[model samples]
Target: MTAVAAGSYPTAPGYNVNVRSGPGTQYRVVRTLPRGARVTINCQKPGQAVTGPYGTTNIWDNIGVGEYVSDAYVRTGSDGYVTGRCG
Candidate 1:
């Protein structure tokens, strides 16, 4: 596990991290990710974003996709759409 670069795409080579719409605890479950899930992150925004009728919580944005993970979930790599180590 390493530090995921902010505003950068995830690259764990088989990581399936969660993706929410908002940035916090109140967010609901928007969707689950599988292995090699790559998502772009918006460092400017923090926490989880909730959306839809259920107000699912997960990494999200109008611009692109973001990931919700700790420093231990993934390792940093060159900026761009990197494959995730999903389980």
Candidate 2:
């Protein structure tokens, strides 16, 4: 996995996005990010596809160490590497 630069992602309005232990919904929910919360995307990886306010995608984003949220629920202004890949 390639390392991407750090970037910001805004959660959907009026919804708390799930931060899972893994990249997919099948994984346990680790925490929740409040609506409109701007988070720092640490990395990204392929995982179970999900539909969020933005759209449907299998792209999952790493928000914290061992924590992730679906890209679909996050609004990243631009698409590309946001930070270095997780080890």
Candidate 3:
């Protein structure tokens, strides 16, 4: 299947989501995205499963080098992976 283009997606409307060092919450919090922040997904990886405003998923979106946010919090339209899988 074709992957969604790398594009900016919004985080859950009113929550400041955590950006982790890896693809899971087990990783350190690298940063925190402010409420209403938008992030351009560079890639994705399967990691810790998370339940958020959208739904439960193990998908983590790479927003930057060493930065990942749960796909559960990003509105990518699809419930599945939107971008290419991170190598």
The candidates, ranked best first by lDDT, are 3, 2, 1
- In candidate 3, list every pair of residues with a backbone clash: none
Of candidate 1, the 10-residue stretch with the lowest lDDT total is 78-87
Predict model 2's lDDT versus the native.
Answer: 0.80
lDDT of 1 by residue, 1-87 (tens): 998664544434555555444455455546656776554444423334434322233422322343344322333332222344222
lDDT of 3 by residue, 21-49 (tens): 99988899988999999999999999999
Screening candidate 2 with a backbone cut-off below 3 angstroms (N, C-alpha, C), the clashing residue pairs are: 3-84, 4-83, 4-84, 5-82, 5-83
Task: Assess the local accuracy of residue 28 in candidate 1 as a C-alpha lDDT between 0 and 100.
Answer: 53
- Between 1 and 3, whose lDDT is larger? 3
> Can you give the lDDT of residue 62 in candidate 1?
24
Per-model C-alpha lDDT, please? 0.41, 0.80, 0.94
Q: Report the alpha-carbon TM-score of model 2 versus the true structure.
A: 0.82
RMSD of each: 11.6, 3.9, 3.1
